[model samples]
Target chain A: MRISVQLKDFDIGKELKLFNNGDTNIGAVVSFHGIVRNNSEKSLMHMDIEQYPGMTQKAISNYVEMAVERWSLYDALVIHRHGKLLLGDRIMMVATAARHRRDAFQSAEFLMDYLKSRAPFWKKEVTKDGYQWVKSVLDDESALERWR
Target chain B: MIKVLYFAWVRERIGVPYEIVETQSGTVMELVEELKQKEPRYEIAFSDLSAIKVAINQELCEFDTKLNGAIEIAFFPPMTGG
Candidate 1:
């Protein structure tokens, strides 16, 4: 398992290749990407992501452990970018590998859902009016609860 | 002593993210009331319980739950992650 929370750009192609490793045993790999979107109603100038260092890593690692135990995944990769991010920025990526598609798919989705609701990261949007902090959506919480 | 954590708006409003408080065994609500008495900043930060959510160690929990041995208590707005 590899987890990275940093302020650097990532190449998906390179990441996928590294994950595959030409290992025949790895039959399935699932990946998900989260990008910054430009909305009409709220033109987001940028986003500032804040996190608590030790706690953030602990929280993410714990989530991954649960996913592996629950889904029988072989390996997983999670990368989340921090600092000032503009429109079209890659916010995060989750990849899971397993011997079967079901394990790969379910683990990938579960990892995303867990990260979406429980990750200890705060996003502040720089809007036209001013910097506004985003609120937690009810649906996000409900999505995580569904898995439990 | 339990370590309390505030995040995002709650942290900004409270002007800090962590505090170590000495308290006897009490419910989360009792801690909230005690926090409100600690300072005006906490009072304003926790004024709307409906907007805030508590977590015991990282799992979502209710404010009325007992905090007998909780090492960490986290307060934040509804999770808007993803």
Candidate 2:
């Protein structure tokens, strides 16, 4: 499994190719990408992301391990970026590989849910209206209930 | 000395990203109380305990969680990640 929390942008095409590793046992791959959005009609100037340096990686890796064990995943890759991001910029991505599509799909969803609810990253959005810290939506936290 | 870190609005109001705190507080709340007593900025930043979250050594935990040799502590708001 690969987990990266960095300031630099990643190449999805390259990441996928590297993720496959020519492993014939893996039959399915499911991936999800998260990008910066401006739902308020171009008002958003940018977003600044902050994270705990030591804890972020460790927390994500623990969840990835759980995903692999539960889904019997062949491989998994998670990349979450930190620092300044503008509208439409890819903020994060998660890919899961398993022998079956259901396992891959479900694991990817699980990872995404975990990231939304439990990850340490914090975002501050600067918009034409004003600069404010983004609050965690209640719905997102509730989304984790399904996994339990 | 424990390393205390803050993020987002907590850091903005506290005026520092991290600090070395010397404390004998047994629980997170005790430590918070001590910091709150140290400066008004800390008091303001931590005014609403319900809005803030705490972590001991990077693992999210309750305010009543014991310190017990923990080397690092962090305070922030609910995560808005991913």
Candidate 3:
């Protein structure tokens, strides 16, 4: 299990290779990547991501632990980036490895669901008009409860 | 003294990133009430409890959680990251 909270973007291929390390016992691997999106109504210039330094990594570890405990995973990994980001930039990624695809896929989704609302990150979108904090969506909250 | 930290808009509105608070408040809500009495900015910043989330010693907890012997507490808006 690994949790990384960083400011720089990660290499997907390199991270996955390191996560699994070509373990022959692991037959299935699943990964999810999150990208910054543009505001449809406004021209988004950039986004500033604020996070609780010590707690951000702590929160992510808890979520990853939960996924690892509930699933038959060989490995679990999460990489989240903070600070300034532009549209289409990769913001985060999670990968899960298991003997079969089911556990890998479910746990990967479960990790993502938890992080969407539980992780200690706040995003402020800057546009031509102004800047505004991205509000937590009700759907995102409900998404977390799905695995429960 | 308890370390009180704020993040995001909470930090922006409160006008300070963090402060060492000396208080007799027993619970998180009581601590909030005490801060609210300090000035109008604290009250304005914490007007909506639903919009805020609290972490006691870096662990998420209810607003009614006890503050006894706690070293740190953080308050921020609901997280929007994934």
Per-residue lDDT for A86 in model 2?
89
Question: Model 2 — TM-score against the truth?
Answer: 0.97
Give DockQ: model 1: 0.51
Name the docking class for model 3.
Answer: high
Write the number of the candidate with greater lDDT, choosing between 1 and 3. Answer: 3
Models ranked on TM-score:
3, 2, 1
- Give per-residue CA lDDT, model 3, range A67-127, as digits (tens): 8888877899999999999999999999999899999999998888888889899999999
lDDT of 3: 0.92
What is candidate 2's lDDT per residue for B1-82, written digit by digit as tens? 8999999999999999999999999999999999999989989999999999999999999999999999999999999888
Model 1, position B10: C-alpha lDDT score: 92
Q: Lowest lDDT 10-mer window, candidate 2 chain B?
A: B73-82
In model 2, the clashing pairs are: none
Rank ordering of all candidates by lDDT, starting from the highest: 2, 3, 1
Off by over 4 Å in 1: B56-61, B69-71
Interface RMSD of 2: 0.7
Model 3 chain A — which ten-residue stretch has the worst lDDT? A64-73
Q: How good is the docking of model 2, by CAPRI class? A: high
Q: Which candidate is the best by TM-score?
A: 3
* Model 2 lDDT tens row, A4-88: 9999999999999999998999999998999999856668999999998988998899899999999999999999999999888
lDDT of 1 by residue, A1-148 (tens): 8999888879888998898877677889999999888756757899888765566677789989998888877788999887888999999999998899999998898889888867877788898888888777777778777687
Off by over 4 Å in 3: none
Interface RMSD of 3: 0.6
